[model samples]
Target: MTKNNLVFETLPLYNKQSLEELLKNRINQLGDFSFEDDKWYYSKKNDNPLRKEDFIVNFYQVPIQYKNELKYYALLSTGLPRVIRTKCNKISQFLKFIDKTYLELTIAEITRSHVNAYEYQLRLKNSATYVKQGYYAAIQDFFMKLTDFDDTPNTVPTKNINPFRYIKEKSKRKPIPKKVIRSWDRVMKDQDIPIPLEFRTFYWLIRSFPNRISELLSMRRDCLKSFYSEYLIQIPTTKQSGGFIQEEIKTIPVAYSGHGKYVINLIQQLQEQTEELLLKNNIEEDIRTDFLFIVQQWGFKNNGDKPSVRYYDQIFHLKKHKINALFKQLAEILDFRDDLNQLIIPTSHQFRHNAVTDRAYAVGYTMEQIRRLTGHKNEVMPKHYTHQLIEKHKEIHLGIENLRSSNVSPVEFRGKIMNLDERTTKQLSRDPRRYLTWEANGKKGVGICSDITGCNPKGTSVHFECYACDWFVPKLEYLKDYKAEYEYWMDVVDRTSGDTKRAAHFENAIRNVSYLERILKICKNGIEHFKEEKLQEQLDKFNTPPVWE
Candidate 1:
């Protein structure tokens, strides 16, 4: 019989107990085997001279060729427990298939033909891709170790060679629909996704800093620094191919988005609130170094002084579970589909997509600018979110004057007009106090300040609420005809402005409003004429002012 030459974590089954115990147990138990550690080994009980071959059968000898197979399997199994278990079960089944022929055959007899036959057998019961790929993966570690062991001069399995490729499964690509892309932003805005601040910061940081989730989660609080009058966050060290890379980069600027200021304000608010809460509970603020998300635990010792904040690991494993739950909730609220199980959730990762779409692509940032911000380095921009592919094509100036009619009064306008979506309008309605201040420019001194400020030139039309030049004027003189209204506004502008620039600004605004009013009148007449029967109903529903008004 072949001598056992493999290492085991525990004593070999054949050497673990007396042979008499194994033979007695075997004879008394109908030739069934009993393993010591629920594995592939047992000793038959017998003190009597037993054949060496029978002992070999009972020993379940680990062949020298397969010596490092289990170890390699274990090495590959780290950090991917699910895949390891799946591969282990599949490999066990395949081993049973090979056992029928090999019994004790030398490892050299294994060939491509034998593997191909096994592949055919697998195809009969499973997908070709699954059988060929899954089985190959299951046996890859064994072959890799076999070849490595064979290279060593002292190794017994010198002739054994590996026979597996390093390639993996290929998948087809599909373009993401614009509807789905837009839905992501809408869903986030409308839903109540209560992600903890640490997770929320990490989520945005991952996409904004373009940091990996694992690396971000593993970071220490000491890695962050807040400098006076600085709008940038400096991360000291980040994981890379060559260990930690030392570099300083501005993450998100506080200039345009206002998110950076908001975050700082929010953190200060949280700190103040937490300290107040602690004081009320008679706890020290010094004991608040725990994860930002954790709440303190309170218990009674009959004297009412048992409040404590328990230390918890910051690398909470709730990301997948929480994201999936939010996706389910959002899908239900949006009436997206009856069964969410069939679709992937619009998760926090999709926020990365939104940033790319809205900020990088839609807002006219160059590809190079996007790459710098996204940290894509040299990788090609994904076709799913390239500006050319993602942006909706439009001739900006063709209907530039249409915007004025978008907010016309109920009586003056009768047609359907395109207004900004709720999210866009809400963002545009922010106070312009911080960015710029406006001054009136009209003959009667009648003007109103713009409600917001920002400048992203969308072709000829730029949405900016310049506080220094904001002014309001009444609608056209005649709702049906605007020649008189245009003349009146032109005269008003000519009489009041101190310079051509101011006069031109007032004239341009009045002309825009006049064109928009005419366009809206045409739209209203069309709607009233086309659908005369439902016109009154539509008007009553949409145009009716509030009861309080």
Candidate 2:
């Protein structure tokens, strides 16, 4: 089949406005478009920054086969110009590693092996785990676009398409333990650093408040509002989860606390500094938005003058690099442990996790409560790894029902606990060497890093297989170990079956307690509510609880 010329009138439906605009602006400077055997041609001096360096777009209107692939790359590059630029560069690097550029590549030409090679190259460059996965996944989507177009006659090889499935990256999230919080508190309170107090406050807010970094960076001054009986700051749609946006304003609510208060104080300090600095240079309306931060150039004597809000077009990327550099410098001065490097690296999303974890401890909030605060619609936590970790712990502590149940005295429970303790100790002693090296003191002193035995090479997950590993063995052992606790859980389960109050107690215990003692405390606290069943049965105390006579 002979390829048709891609003229102004013949462009695809999705290509309408952009092609129309480009054609109008360039028709005079450029000539008619034409197609030759297996190739396409168009000539126009480029003005779009992305195309400016290339000067000309060569190749036939991307073959119908490659059009969708192009659009997929285009969709993934959706943020700011800088974001697109960075993403494009990353894509281009993959293309080069594969030895094909936009014109030279076809959907069918891409393959899983090619992706694997690119991944290997990326690993050699020491690309971070996420970066490697992101770039390759993007490339896969680029190939996917080939399937979406209106004119394509055939599909890319299905087998070669989704390289990410073969090379999924493992979870990189490091759970911040209490000690990390202590270190952050110590440094922030030192008050002797050369860093501006405002910057320090920004750092504190992110660490304390459940906010994505981009949301924090894009915070406009007006988003601040009174919430939960105190003033709270809202972070609108940022780059990560697309902060809740209203009227073109992306935002999330941050309630008042030691951290939230610090954030508010820092905003006032920066606003004053920005206003004074701008006014000194004769900049106008320094008060347009209530943004807590704005981009300014670092000229010989840079003015704090606002760049027409258009500057915010590149806000996400610019702010990310800015914040990353800031923390990196701080990491240097504090002689911060290299171990914390992964945690401290500027990421807007991690702050949201920190808030969830910190609040889960402080307020004893359930996952659902924390989820509501973080704006997660479903029960998914800030990161999958975290959710999985919590689920693992939940399985251990909350698996009381799975144990065999029969009438057993508390003494039997105590005896079983002692026996289990002895068995675990004996097992550990048998493999003491396996546990010793993994227990070295970290910055947090005998840190959770001791659990690093669980760590694996991130990227390319291994499917969980019971047939391959006996994960169920421990669950079985628990059933045999604590017969009394198991019976108690069964009782709770039966009591709560038709009773909402009892069900809530079980859920509360799962969310709030990790240790056996803590579990008892939570259950005890809810005992009053559970005991009121008879009172509830007497009559509906709709208004006032008819004087507890």
Q: What lDDT does each candidate get?
A: 0.35, 0.40
Q: Per-residue CA lDDT of candidate 2, range 134-200, in tens? A: 7766564444332323343233322343333345568987655555556756766666534455456
Candidate 2 vs. true structure, TM-score: 0.39
Give the C-alpha miss distance for residue 141 in model 1, angstroms.
4.5
* TM-score of model 1 vs. true structure: 0.35
Listed per model in order, the count of residue pairs whose N, CA or C atoms clash below 3 Å is: 15, 22
Candidate achieving the largest TM-score: 2
Candidate 2: regions farther than 4 A off: 1-150, 154-165, 169-180, 190-195, 238-251, 254-259, 282-291, 295-318, 335-353, 359-549
Cα lDDT of model 1 by residue, 373-489, tens digit: 457875355544432322211112123312343234222122121222443233222311122222222222111222221121111112212211112212222333334444554
Which stretches in model 1 have alpha-carbon errors above 4 Å?
1-68, 76-79, 106-117, 123-126, 151-223, 226-258, 261-318, 327-345, 360-549
